[model samples]
Target: MHTQRISGQAGQTGRRWGALAAAAALVLGAAACSGGSDGKSAGGKVELTYRIWDSTQQPAMQKIVDAFEATHPSVKVKIQLTANQEYWTKLQADATSGSAPDVFWMNGPNAQLYESNGMLLPLSDKLAANGVNLADYPSSLVSLYQHKGKQYGIPKDFDTVGLWYNKKLFDAAGVKYPDDTWTWQTVQEAARKLTDASKKQYGILAPAFGQENYYNTIFQAGGSVISADGTSSGYDQPAATAGLKFWTDLIKDGSSPSLKSMTDTFPSQFFESGKVAMYYGGSWNSSTFAKNSALKDDVDVAVLPQGTKRAVVIHGLANVAYAKTKHPDEAAALVAFLGSKQAAEIGAKESGVIPAFNNTQQAWVDATPGFHLQAFLDELPYAMPYPTSKNTSVWQTQEPITFAPAWEGKSDVGAVAQKMADLMNTALSKEK
Candidate 1:
């Protein structure tokens, strides 16, 4: 699941809706001048707007669009890029006003929200008619976009978290690099050895972020954020408390920077600046690290350290069509083509992400040979779907607030966990 926050203020909602109204007005004005709603322009060409968040994937998406345009000369695809932080808010505003993009990106966090509200077009029928099998994609990803029994989105790309370490720092501290055999105890030992107060360098950086930091540890420790039935919270359990305390203990022991320090400078920034020896990060960082001149040959990734069990949080983005789009057939066609093996190959070749298409992820591994990219794919078997309920955003928004005292060293981990559980249970109880 994407972790970027969407605007939650009531006033921001009005402003966003106003912005959507203005955008819709512009589109309507243009359409009135052109005089067509069947994807046909005044020039007799079919025009469709495709929206997405990641600028890194735009080149590959454009390549796929170009290929589609070449095959269907009558249809023209226009690319619309939005920053991820604002993408959901804009999409929601547009959806509320009946003017969402013909096709756009969707993630696990908001998939159910849009699908349940009838804002998304279910694609199962279209995929079947076109001879596209859902089995061609990862089963977990296929399930992620399914609400009730209808598939509302097509899997585009996926990511998993891993232990990213600086090899130079490890060598300097005489600590072995993390590997598959590493565990929680092993990491703690390494963290102790790698810390250097004189140099103001830390062994690790464990920020309060859930997906990148604690969520993986929570699962590894045999804990669940939410119960299997999605009816309750698990934070009060001992395993959950242990998972949370692991990081708090690190901060208390000075193995990592204080939470305040990390909040000021994100953990990734600290790792890139050589102030942190190890970082828990997602597979998406491989391309980013490869492009960082300062970290060119100094960084490598390892499977996350294990606890009672080994686990990673798996998630991906999917392409979904707007339910109210004027050009349903054209929009579904674009969504299917984007989720095809050919499009996945283009994404992998561009090093955009691990493609969801069956047997097509190796290109992503080979694209960045310096780091162990396969570690992410190898993690699939033990990966858990990123935790979510119908209204995941509701409780998730409360996480940092409820867990802050624990991260700040002002409260016992168990106490804070109990408070989180109480808060989350109340939220989950209302999810229906």
Candidate 2:
């Protein structure tokens, strides 16, 4: 689903995963799966159904498919567009019925679950035989789809977080524009100067979000969400408290809006409406902001403000094949092409996404001349992988519930952090 970037609710990472918890059981309970039979067409063309969720990227995907068919005329690829909300549910039902699509999009949150359940076709050997180089993609993204030393998918595109700001607001406040050298203190000072109570303007949106807000800070503070071995929670650590305190302090100083204000209206609305001066958002926001008439000319992005060190959260979508596909050779051929540099180049020029293939992101950067899209690429070296464990949705759904009080200013940040750690630890313990 590429984290539901194409939608207007792109900023709300919450709505994307709640329903995943319900779909988890269905995925787990499903029997060994097989793909639907969409064999040879009238002209001896072998047709394969490829499923994806983002309509915005469908055109680019179709171009990639067209290229693949140009060489392999006998094999035809059909793209099935399903909305993110219903994508997982329908895939679960299809998997249970042994009729899943031959190829489909997979995200970090669900990669381990699908791989562990044996619903995905491991492509390590197949990729090597196809002369596909894993080195072509960022190592973090490559590692996201691996399970027990097996590669389950090939990264299709990648996205990282950035510090987005309104240039007009910064100019109006007489503050210097943010740059690579900016740090936590710099953000605090700028946020203070940029905020105006009378105008209902804020410095930034310190929302109760994972990928867009606190996760990157947690990493930059030298803290982690899950233990290295993925068996424990790191939220109980002291550094995590510092990471979390960074946001709570902004609320305390009234530089940022109350969690209630953001809750009543999404944080993105505040920024897009020009009520907020700065924001922490994903690279996907590039396309969203470009379409916005109010912000198209005024909004720009920079690397996230450093805490103890510089860091950002990197996440992306991958392409995988069904384990029991009817036409294994055809499916493997399609998957291989989808991960190739040629396909990535097509997507980069047309998809408005950061293609995962190395050296291919510049097109996406140049596509949006209005913003400093390079900020997203610059943080790649220090980017942290989006955290996930087997059955990630179990703990993901609990995060907001467990941390809401702190965000709402009703409980101490440290106290609620420890509570979240305990809750996350219990959930991690239950993963198979």
| lDDT for each residue of candidate 2 in 147-174, tens digit (9 for 90 to 100) | 9999888889888888889999999999
**Which stretch of 10 consecutive residues in model 1 shows the poorest summed lDDT?**
9-18
Q: How close is candidate 1 to the true structure, as a TM-score?
A: 0.89
Tell me how far the alpha carbon of residue 303 in candidate 1 is from the true structure, in angstroms, after superposition: 1.0
In model 1, the clashing pairs are: none
Model 2: lDDT to the true structure: 0.83
Question: Candidate 2, after superposition: displacement of residue 344 in Å?
Answer: 0.7
Candidate 2 TM-score, C-alpha based: 0.95
lDDT of 1 by residue, 48-104 (tens): 889887676788889999998887788888889887667766776566555678898
